[model samples]
Target: MPVCPYCQVEMDDDLDTCPNCGITMIYFFKCQRCGQEFATTGILKFCPLCDADLSEQMN
Candidate 1:
């Protein structure tokens, strides 16, 4: 479970937009294996760097 930084509302980890604030929540990610950083508009399933499955590794 993660909270929206802007509205402080509880939200699902896979959500890209805040239900309460109606704002798009872009996620910044870093690959665990390769240490590669990237940005996504929503939840991502894999790391662009090493093609690693990021469902479990991402926050």
Candidate 2:
């Protein structure tokens, strides 16, 4: 499960729109080294696949 960024509510991975906040979800994290995109809880500082520093790529 992933938490909705807007409403801070837990949601299913298959959902594109948040059920609690009605906001469209986007994979806000993108790795500059591997070009991988994912949604995170702000605890991850590196790309899971390439180990690239994702501290600055929060958009």
Candidate 3:
């Protein structure tokens, strides 16, 4: 299972992206506003906290 860095919530590890925050997988990603530690596969673009767009928020 995967853990949401923003909320520390448990999620499915196979998720290519987070359903709640839209974060990727593997790489280190932190909520720009809240400063939470998350892993991203480098394919998302939203903070999920303040709903801000990440570098890759859209597909």
Candidate 4:
């Protein structure tokens, strides 16, 4: 199960939007430098853990 970012409600993984808050589900970002993935609500230009530039990576 995944928690909604807006309401913090637990939801199924197959859903793309939260039922309670109506916010979009998590967006995954892969860090090219460290080969790690991050979950965010929107687009991120840099990795939070590695500080790598992620603008070139495909969403």
Candidate 5:
């Protein structure tokens, strides 16, 4: 079993969706503000690294 970062819920390593939160299990960094963890390894509007809006950082 693996722990989900979004909700800190436990889930099967091979499974796709989370049994508790219903979020798709994936590799991501959680955003401190919205509590939304996003996928990495690609360009994203937010902190796929943390789900933080990148536009805010651009300032």
Candidate 6:
């Protein structure tokens, strides 16, 4: 799992923004299940690439 360098939370490596700290331009998310990468403007509940339930992983 890729960790948010700022928030220190386990993040989906496919995302370019930290779900906890909202950091961008550096951090990104990669799907733990599908290993797909994507960008985000805000908190997402599911992965657009694989439709993974991202909310459950946040906690």
Task: Give me the candidate number with maximum TM-score.
Answer: 1
lDDT on C-alpha atoms for all candidate structures: 0.84, 0.75, 0.65, 0.79, 0.60, 0.69
Using lDDT, give the best candidate's number: 1
lDDT of 2 by residue, 8-57 (tens): 99987667788988887755677889888787533467889999987785
TM agreement with the true structure for every prediction: 0.70, 0.46, 0.37, 0.52, 0.39, 0.43
Model 3: per-residue Cα lDDT over 20-59, one tens digit each:
8876556656666677666656545777567666665232
| lDDT tens per residue, model 6, 1-59 | 76777778887757767788888734246677798876666557788878887776553
Output the lDDT of residue 11, model 6: 74
lDDT of 1: 0.84
Q: Each prediction's Cα RMSD? A: 2.0, 7.1, 10.5, 7.5, 10.0, 7.6
Write down the TM-score for model 3. 0.37
Off by over 4 Å in 4: 1-21
Q: Rank the candidates by TM-score, best first.
A: 1, 4, 2, 6, 5, 3
Q: Which ten residues in a row have the lowest lDDT in candidate 4?
A: 50-59
If both were scored by TM-score, which would come out higher, candidate 4 or candidate 5?
4
Off by over 4 Å in 3: 27-59
C-alpha positional error of residue 58 in candidate 1 after TM-score superposition, expressed in Å: 2.4
Question: Residue 8 in model 4: shift from native, Å?
Answer: 24
Q: Candidate 5 overall Cα lDDT vs. reference?
A: 0.60
Best-to-worst lDDT order: 1, 4, 2, 6, 3, 5
Clashes found in each candidate (C-alpha, N, C closer than 3 A): 0, 0, 7, 0, 2, 8
lDDT of 3 at 16: 66
* Better model by lDDT: candidate 1 vs candidate 3: 1
Against the correct fold, how does model 4 do in TM-score?
0.52
